[model samples]
Target chain A: MAHTIANKQKITARVRRIVGQLNGIERAIESEVSCSAVLQQVAAARGALGGLFEELLEDHLRQHVAGAHLSDADRQAGAEELLALIRRYAR
Target chain B: MAHTIANKQKITARVRRIVGQLNGIERAIESEVSCSAVLQQVAAARGALGGLFEELLEDHLRQHVAGAHLSDADRQAGAEELLALIRRYAR
Candidate 1:
């Protein structure tokens, strides 16, 4: 999406932080950190991932599905695509 | 937790896969892959992370909060800890 390209730096930073968090979990496991601590790390990473998803989803909806210039058929296709993604994600 | 230790390998593997998925997202961004494709990868990684959280939470509930031998006080504390985690994660 054009919006994603426009926000590429922000999205990349978010993704990098999530990668760091995931790596932290691995290190915690290797070091035999307490389960509760590791669980917290996992939850933090999960939340970050969810944030990324939400941003991208919003961009997709705004630019592709609900854009002012989109034809009705294009809008319908975008909506179906989004719905499929939501189903898969929610699964 | 003792349960985490018992299942260390499985947990580590899951974490590794999540890291790989995250790396894939970064690569996709760097390569200027379509937004939809990148979004799908994010969703997949988020789902995997959620699955890991679910596994760890179940283990925590079974061994710490709901264990047959746990004292009432310990059970209460465990439940509180879990609630805190859930709140943080949901936020």
Candidate 2:
């Protein structure tokens, strides 16, 4: 949480770019662009979103799961949280 | 491409929902929401994007690569195109 707060600007910028990509996809579809072109844009957006997820996942692991200061219970909870997230993301 | 044109409304709706999800993420960040909650939203958006990609990929495969009417050369070209797209998407 603190890590995210510290990196708020960076995260926000990434989110903004992803939003723009999604909008481009919507516009392409609305205008009946070539399927290949629209697929390319969708892939780009997915990749960008994956990048953001990886960044957040790394932060969460460092702060919550792998911190040297965390107790056993806290680490266990963090592991469960991460596992649940991975399952959802994989779906 | 024909497949996409036929399903334009469906694809557009998915894109619109994804855009809304991204906007929600941006707003959550602006409001200083919990990292876990933000992460959940991000994962949901990623999953949605993945679903769209899978849909497009399947359509491309069926229409371009796997059509029985296609010649060997055409299938080869489709395979190459799909390979390129998968590489990009995987990255």
Candidate 3:
């Protein structure tokens, strides 16, 4: 719906960039980059991936769980899901 | 620390149940709840305030711009501020 139109392109671009980053990480590992340098890239890629998840989660809440046809239970469930996600990824 | 002990008590109990659903929608429009049931509780309190701004922008992008120590232009400017907040709150 409206949300999809607003975010589809940006999300697609992010995913594409993340894929490239992952490939680059593989190359780094294969070439035996210094441990610290390789770890830095790994951390950066993780951040990008987390950004993707965050964007999608926000869109889902704004369009489906939180803003659309749903019961109070659904809202609570969505909130719980969000909490769980934050716990899992941010830790 | 540690994602604020895993999401700060479920986002403070969803902002205290959305402030009791905005004081029950201002007492259901000052006690004259008739216009389509007060517009369906004002569209369910605007979907629980868009699920508390989508769980605080997904815990600030899984803890500060996609997993911390950000670069890559702050992860694409935090994905263009989440596509301009899903195009201003899903239209």
TM-score for each of the candidates = 0.83, 0.81, 0.42
Per residue, candidate 2 scores C-alpha lDDT tens digits across A1-91 of 2334338899999999998898888888888876667888988898898889888888888888898999898888878888887887777
Superposed model 1: Cα runs more than 4 Å off: A1-6, B1-5, B68-71
Clashing pairs in 2: none
Please write out the lDDT profile of model 2 over residues B1-91, one tens digit for every residue: 2334348888888899998999999888888886777889998898899889889888888977898898898788778878888898877
DockQ, each predicted model: 0.49, 0.47, 0.02
DockQ of 1: 0.49
Q: Which stretches of candidate 3 lie over 4 Å from their true place?
A: A1-6, B1-91
Report lDDT (CA) for all predictions: 0.83, 0.82, 0.65
Q: Write the per-residue lDDT of candidate 3 for residues A13-39, one digit (tens) a residue.
A: 998999999899899999999989989
Give candidate 2 regions above 4 Å deviation: A1-5, A68-72, B1-5, B67-76
What is candidate 3's CA lDDT for residue A89?
51
lDDT of 1 by residue, B53-86 (tens): 8888888888888989988887888888789878
Worst 10 residues of 1 chain A by lDDT: A1-10
Ranking by DockQ: 1, 2, 3
RMSD of candidate 1 to true structure, Å: 2.8
lDDT of 3 by residue, B18-51 (tens): 7888788789889988989878887887778776
Q: Where's the lowest-lDDT run of ten residues in candidate 1 chain B?
A: B1-10
